[model samples]
Structure formats: C-alpha cells, structure tokens
Target: MLSLAGWSVLIQASLAAIPSYVMQCAYLPGKILDGVDRVNRNFLWGSSDSAKKVNWVGWDKVTKSKEERGLRLHSAKGRNIALLAKLNWRFQIESEALWVKVLKMKYSIKRGRDIFNKGSRWLVGKDSGLNVWHSNWTNGGSLRKLIHGPITQEASFLEVKDIMLDTGWDWGKIPFEISLEIKRMIQAIPVTILSRGAGKLIWAGSPQGTFDLRSAYRLAMGNNMVFNKKNRNSSLALEIVRQALEYYHCVASPRLQTCKVLKGIRWERLPQGWMKLNTDGSANGNPGLAGCGGVIRNDAGQWVVGFSKCIDITSSFVAELWGLREGLILCCNLYITSLEIELDAKVIVDILNKPAYVNNIISPILDDCRLLASRIPQIRVKHCFRQANRCADSLARMSVSLDSVFSSFHSSPVDLLDVFEDDFNGVNVNKLCPEPDVPL
Candidate 1:
C-alpha cells in the first residue's frame, strides 16, 4: 500500500503529465480538466470503486505549494494558462524563430501581444532612435497620448535626444512648457546607451528584463491570490494532511542511504598552448565594500601574473565584472593571444557570451570586457566551481581588507601561497557529496 507521500510522487510523475503536453499549445475543455482533477483527487485519497473516501480539503488547496500548506500539484487550468503565456512571451521576444515567423504569416497573432506590451517598455540606449513623444518608452503609453494638449507639428517631431544631456535631462533644450511633475517623471526614467548595439524592448516586471512564466502567471492571476475554504475543523484537517505527508518521508519513498562519498574537485590546468585565467569577486555585504581579484596561470598551473583591487561600495555582480575587466586588460597589455577565462559566477560568463542580452548598468564594464576580448584572437570563457578557483577567491577576499587601490603581483601573494601551491601540485580538495538513497 502506497503512503500519502508516495501517492503524491506517483501523481506528480505519472498522472499529472497526461494533460501537460496538450495544455501548453491548446486549451483543454472545462469538462476534460474537471475529469482529470476528479481522478487525481480520487487517486490521492486512495478512493476505490468499492469504497469512496471523502475529500477532507478542497482540490484547490491540494494544488497549492508547501508554503501554502499543500502538496504543490498544479491545477490543470492554471498550468495551461501559465504555459501558454510562456509561448506568448517567446513569440514577442523571438520574432525571428521559424515557428513565430510561420505563425505570423499564417495568422495575425494579436491575442496576448497587446497585454504583454502594456507591461513592457524600451530599454533605452542613446535616445536618438526613440521619439520623445511617439516612442513606447514610458510606463503604459506614448508621451503624445499621455500628454493632454496637442502641440505644433515641428514641436511634436522632437526626438528623445534633443531634450537629453550627458548627465541628465536638458531642461533648456525642452521646447514646450511641461509641468514640474512631468519633468520629474521624465528625469526618473533611465536613458542608458551601451558601447555596442541599440536600445531593445524588455519586460518591466523582471529585473533581468526578460519575461518569466512565474512572474507572468503571477501578474496574470493577480499577486494576492488567497484560497479560502469553507469547512469545519479546517486547521485540524490541514494538520492531519501534514502529518500524513511526513509519515512516509523517512521510511517510505525517501529511503535515504548514508554513505560518505569523496567529491574531488581540483583546479584544472589549461591546454599546452593556452593560458588560464581564474577571477573572483567578493563583498562584505551585497552593496557594502566590494573588491575583485584574479590570477593568470600557464598550462602547468604556474602563476604568471595576478591582481587585486578594492572597489568602494557596489554590487557583487559589478565587483565580479571589475575583476574580469582587470584580467582582460592585463591579458591585452601582455599580448596573451590564446586565453581561457574561468569564474565562479556563471551569470557573468553568460552575459559575456551573449552580447545581445544587454543590461544598461553593467554595459560599460561589459563593453570593456568585450572590447578587450575582441583584441585577443583566441579566447574561451568558462564557469568553474568555487572550490576549483580557491586561489583567486582568497585573493578577492583579501582585497576587501586593503585600501581602495589596484595592486598587481608578479609572483603568488604571500597569504595565497598555500592554495596556489596546492593548485600547482594538482592537489584535490575534499568535498562531501550528499548520501545516496538506500533502496528497500
């Protein structure tokens, strides 16, 4: 006999997948979804044809996450809409895709595009291409529609660049009389330009300026969704369900085996012809004192050059880029043609690899990294585990204590010699891996 947790796993793995494939592209009928939900409830409660059991908590409650005191089994209807929203997001962003192009040619494709546009805006560059009045750069609509009165044709033709300065909004250059509130509103909006590429449209909801299904679905469904159940002893019933859920975790499906396994992680040397660069960044707190450090080593793991710089208060991401930027600059100065770059942070490596995905704040340093990288004929960017880049990580941590300055080391730093020696000797660092599950 399967426990409640076992049933939860069985339903999630085998039963729930039945409708998910079709639900993404097409909407299933209400009857079909209801039928599926009925089956799931029956199966979950161990209801048989001979003996039907009463559903203590509502099906809606069961579909909610653990935080909400539920099993986190997705409702077919909600899952369908979220999945379709993802497709709609992809259609807008990936216009060049063959599927999107074909759909565009065959159908008008205007279903959710308008709704998505309402929540999105232009990631402004130099402000030349975008019109001061006509561009879809503001929160909801264009400046022309947002403003109450109509202006002269010549005045209306003004572009964003005409009223923008290097520092901020050029008040004197603004031709028409705008209210103080409107001026402040325009000034608050960031109009940033990168070294390469023009302004791109991005979803305003996400920090990365990309459309995510979770955020989209949350926005679509409304953020504050409360599930209210009208049943006697609801709190007592939920406690019973929780106890049932935890009943089998130790003895049933989780079936844990405790065995010590050695996860040997070591700093890898580059190819004979290529030099490896390991860079890392550290901060006392995210927005507190930040710094970066990096080291360049040959094929035999012998350090050629290294640097440590203590940057004042900044984000960890910026600190990471600073280390990479300094390393690239060093490589350029030394004319190191063949290079392999390694960093513990994977996102920075991704941004470096995909230049089209630009964030205005990081563009300046990212542009520098790109430009410096372009100088080198052969270059490879890779992500390494934090354990593998211990030497560089230690250097980065050390920079936090030093005064704000860029210091270069011809040889290994005195404090970092132990880790450096371990790395050079190809010594493996001991890491305890999670114990495997013991089968009954």
Candidate 2:
C-alpha cells in the first residue's frame, strides 16, 4: 500500500502531467468522470472507498480555495473551463491565426441575424459590424423583435456609429421615425467611450471583458448572481473590507496572499413565527427536461419538508414559478399561517409582488400561487441569493436525475445533510459576487 506521502506525490504528479490540450478540448463522458473521481479518491486517502479510510475533509471542500473554506485543490469542472478559457483568450489576441481567420469567415456578423448565436456576441466599440435592427449589441435580443414597423431603405446597412454624435447617441440622426419604446430601447443600449479598436466579439455570459475559467464554470453550473437593493449594505461592507486589505500588508499571510478573504454572504432564518420556503427549478436546456424543488423550514430553523418533481418541457422561469406554486400549496395544506417564499429568480418575484402586472405565459400559475398565498394569514414572496437556498437547489438538481415524477423527503436525505447543516448554522456556501470590470 502506498504511504500517505506517496499518495500525495502521486496525486500532484497526475495533475501536473495531465495534457493541457485534452483539458481544453475534451468534454469527459460520465463514465470517464466517474473513473477519474475514483482515481482521485484512491490517491487522496490510499483507498477508493470512504468506508475503509476517512477523507478527513470532504472532496468538495478540498477542491475549493481557502477563502471558500477549502483546501485549494482544483475541481475537474473548474480546471476544464480554466483550460478552455485559454483558447477563448487565444482567439482574442491572435486574430491573425489561420484558425481565427477561418472562424471569422464562417461566423461573419450579419445584421439582425444570429443575434442569439451560442458562442459570443460582438461588443459595439466602433459599431462597424452592428446593425440598428438585428444585432444584440444594444440590450439583449434583436431590436427588430421589439419594433412594430419596418425600417426605411436608408436605414439598411447603417452601422451603430451613424446614430452617434461624438460621445453619445444622436437620436435626430436616425433616418426613420422612432417610437417611445424604440427610444427607450436605444437609450438602454449603452455606448461606452471606445478607447481603441472597432468592436470585438465577446462571450455574452461572461461579465469580465476577458475570458476566465471561473465565469465559464458558473455558466456551466447554471449558477446566477442575484442582486437586490437590500444587498447594497452587504456589498458596501465587502467593498470597505477589500479596500482596507489592499492597503494593509501586515495582516496578510502566505495563504492570504494566494487567497484573499473576500466578503461572503450567509443564510438567515425567517423572523419569529414565520416559516421560510425556498423554491428552485432546473432544466437541462432552457426548455428541455425540467424539474422543480422546494424546501420549507420553521422559524426555529428545523426542516419541515422538502419536495422534488419532474415537470414537462418548460422554460426555467416558468419552472421556478411552478416550484413556488407547489410549495405554497404544500404550505396551505399544512395550515401554515405565516409563510415567507424565497426564490432566486428576480423576475418572478417582481411579477408576483406587482398588483397590476400580468404575464400571459405565467398568469395561470401566478393566480394559483396568489390564491394560495392569500389564504395564509401572513405571506410574502421575496427574492434571495441562490447561495442561501442550497437545500432547494440540491433538490432541483436531483429532480433531473431521478426517474420518478415526484419525491418528498420527510427527513433530510444523506446527500442533503451538509446543505441542511449549513443552512441551520448560517454557514455560507456558493456565494458569488459580481465580476469586476477589466481595465480598458
């Protein structure tokens, strides 16, 4: 049997010797990932089975950095994205490469078309490639979808710069008449002062102007950083701590040098006499195989119940709304008078809280949720950071994997024990802050 030191050396050697190109291009199959995980487990403790040898710290914990309360070991998924991001970076800097030229030729930017293409979207710097109607350079999707009328022949093939006067947009320069809605959309599309170059295409999901593994992994994992006005105080506190740490080197240790103590968010229990309900939904593709899950806990922080259910093909937003609706129904059945529903989707919360808002797509489900909520003596729907809703998040992921249409856990499942413990103790996990801007 290999000694503990031998195992450590072997694991390090395996990581160091792995081919970078394979990491960049290869998406490992489930079987390969399972085999790799087994290898990693065997090397970590000289045994594949956790029953035979204790892993002192969990594998997930080991993969995270110190600031995240982990051992700094890289995750397979993270390493994959990190390595792939290098390819994305290469595309940006090596524009003259033969591969780059081929890609550019194959994926030329057309006006109004391919706006929602999978890979990346062009940023409007000089706006040469952007179209006033079709391109997603402005807000999100195509502007043509928002407009009720066609553009004039004079407006055809016109670049974004044509409507610009010096630093800002010249509304009067537009060839065709514009509506208030069009004006609002045009104004929403920001025209940042271009320092150099005629706009370049960038990954739409990425917040950083440059490619990075962390952002890629978040996109892969379906994690989103939900923001709200209530979180401003925490954001401010985090910024202060960051600035203080920047000026004071005395407090920094070697570990701190490698991993800064970033401000993290934690889960808080509901107020006295209130029950907290966290609901989440998952879909393989946006409208693919979808599922919903929810967990409820009393004010004292004890788990009441948790449920997961497979839903037919639906968008994630609809699935999320359905999850809340189901959770509300469950709460109503239990005769819970005071309830607080927490969801990660801000759009749904905004709609539910709005008395006059009406969405044709979600109206039926929204009506059911509101009706159930109204029956409860005290009820409210609030948006929360996904980090604080791990139990429901776990259940949502499980919903896709399970064969059954629905399942409920009267007691916490083994897989959920850690999440439940963290929730109970107010320990934070998976807290994501917004990405900082790249230097111009």
Candidate 3:
C-alpha cells in the first residue's frame, strides 16, 4: 500500500495530469475542499496573467472575483457538458429506460454512503487524525466502521452536506437572499391586506392618483416589470408598492362591468347561488340584418326568462351593448337582487370600468349602463369565455329567422309554419329547428 505522503503526491499528480478542459468542466467555483487543498494549494493561489497563460490558478482567481462581484462566469464548453448531463439525468427519469438503471446506480455511488464513505474516511484518516495515538481507534476507526455499511446513514449525511456546500445552497452570505426575502415580504403584505377584503382602504388614492396607479400597475405587470421606473414615473420603491396595490385591488374586487351597446336582454338561474343574465346581438353589415337575444336565470338553475329579437341595428358592438342593457333592465324588472352579467367583449368591459370623457359615440351609452348598474345591489358584470355562452349565441342567431319572430308570446307553443306561412311555403319549422346537434 502507498504511504500517506506517497498517496498525497499521487493525488496531486493525478489532478495535475487532468486535462485543462476536464478540470474546467468539473470545477464548481464555490465547493468546499476535501483533503487535497494542502497538496494542491496552487488550485486556490492564482496567477497574475490568465489571458496569455491558461493557468488553473488564474482561472480560480477570476471565478472567485466574479462570484464576489455578484456575477457568474461560465466556460462555454463546461456549461455545455453540464447542461448535457442535466438533460441526460432528466431523460433517464422521464423515459425510465434501461439507462435509468445506470443513472440510478451512478447517483447511488455519488450520493450513497457506502462508496463515498470509504473514500472520505480514507482521506480524513490519512490527514486529520493521522498523528493521534488513539486517533485510528477513536475518530478514524469509528468513522471507517460507520461508513462501511452498504446503506451507511452517516455517508448520506456527509454527501448531502457536500452537495449543499458545492451548490452554495446555504443562504447565509448571498446578497440575493436579502433582496429575495424583501420581495417575498412585500408580496405577502398585499396578499394579506386583500384577503381581509380591504378594498376601500387600499384604493384610497386621489382620483388622479388612482388613475396614475392603475396606469402604472397596468404598464408594469402587463409589460412584466416588478419595479418599473420608466413607466411608473416614480421611485423604484414606489413602483413596487404600486404593483402590490394593483395586485391587491384585482384580488379584492371581483365585480365586472357590462358593455354599453347590446340591445337584447335575458336572465337565467345558475346552479351556484347567483343569477346570470346573458345577452347577445348580431348585425349583418354595419347595422344591417341585426338580431339580439337575452336569457335570465336565478341561482337555482331555473330559467327565469328568455328574450330574442331581430333589430335594425348598426354594429355588432352596438348589439352587444344593447344586449347588456336589456339584461340589466330585466334583472331590475324582476326584482332579482344578486346578479352576474356575462359577455365575451373585452373592449366593452374595459370601457365600462374606465369611461373616457372624450367626444365618443359610445361614451354616453356606456355611462348609462354604469349608472344603471351602480343603482342595483350586488350586480357584477364579467367577461365570459365564448364557449360558456353558446346557448345565448344560438338564440341570437335563431331570432334572425323571420318565422321564429311572429311566433313569439303565444301562451301556447306555435308551429314554425304558422308564423311565416308565405316564407315556409311547405317546409316544416319544427324540422328546421333540428335539435341543435352539438352538445352545450
């Protein structure tokens, strides 16, 4: 067996013989030393000039400097190899192929106690406890026995510590840790405030200030900046505060506003404890063969009322707004208390929330809808995904058929041929109303 000194020399020689590329690839900048530091002191001690001479010592110095400055320096070739290894590990786990067995074996060897325990005890015994009389019996011998098991628990503990130190997983000295902690604290504050339903307290900014806050929040979150300085037109700290406030406002207030132009009105009862009013309208050409429909339902999933009408409308947007107004009016007429109005128009929703004072045709109509909504108790308007409103959309399309129109308000169900006798000519309206083949 090689003497301790001989073993140390052999280890140093092996490290020295390692290709520069291999060393660069395997070298993790912040990993703690094993027993090789004394023999390979040159690894830490840097050279003066690195660009001209490819010295391992110089590379180590540059890496340390970059890390101290909160910058990461990576060798292209080294990163590629590391990335490949990571991908390979992921592939093995996901694919669960034969290679996964090999990977698990490798991971066991690297992370398992038995293999690494023997190496660690060997190194520690030959170095730290070498000179003690009972060192072998106490520290070294005990450690050897402790690490000798196939599934040595002590080895796992040491391996975990080694990995943590290698990866700089400890948060003790990292500058980013403080910043991250502060961010988390700030984010947590808004969430806590919002959870308590404190909207008025949170949105207590002046009217102009509220607008500014809204604008700033929109720009920041929409553009994906946690603390936007240029768009916020304020200090970085204030920007972050504004973002938090906006987030709080969104979570606390779930009320939605309706479009101003739709003409049809209808109501429906949802399974949940709330009333749903659906309105839809269509225009052929800039207000041509336009049609609108509305449905009202109460919280008990019962159809409260339904309406469909073909109107000589101007635009699709106008029809949509009219549908909203009709729905709201129906809710008021029925004395329904808690209401949720849903539409698919995003523009109408935004316009209702923040009405512009400019000379726009839709302004007055939108303001009217907003005013009407404010008078009602617990009325919310929301944008629904199109898929959710297919029933209402079908009714709107059905209303445009002339035969379906005059058959309206018949205390009895009227046959399709009775309403438009001339148009039907001999075709059956019942056959035409073919069970809307698609599932709702």
Q: For all the candidates, what are their Cα RMSDs to the real structure? A: 10.2, 22.6, 27.8
The local distance difference test score of model 2 is: 0.66
Expressed as tens digits, the lDDT of each residue in 1-440 for candidate 3 is 65534533554356433433443224333232222332243332321334232333433333222213211222222333333333332442355677666666665322212211211111111112232121222212332333323533433233212212221233342222234332222111111100122111101112211112222222222222212212334256766787999999988996575334322222223456678876676777653556667666556544567666654434677667766765666677777778888776776666666646331233333444766677678877777555445445655666667565311221211332232222213222221112334577
If the candidates were sorted by their TM-score against the true structure, best first, what order would they fall in?
A: 1, 2, 3
Model 1 gets an lDDT of: 0.74
Compose the digit string of candidate 2's lDDT tens values, residues 200-298.
Answer: 555545433344455454434333221110222335666778788875755564333233345566668878999988999987775556788998899
Instruction: State which candidate has the highest TM-score.
Output: 1
Pick by TM-score: 2 or 3, better one: 2
TM-score of 3: 0.31
Tell me the whole-model lDDT of each prediction, alpha carbons only: 0.74, 0.66, 0.42
Backbone clashes, each candidate: 0, 1, 24
Candidate 2 weakest lDDT stretch, 10 residues? 223-232
Clashing pairs in 1: none
Model 2: C-alpha RMSD to truth? 22.6
C-alpha positional error of residue 324 in candidate 2 after TM-score superposition, expressed in Å:
0.5
Error of 2 at 240 (Å): 40
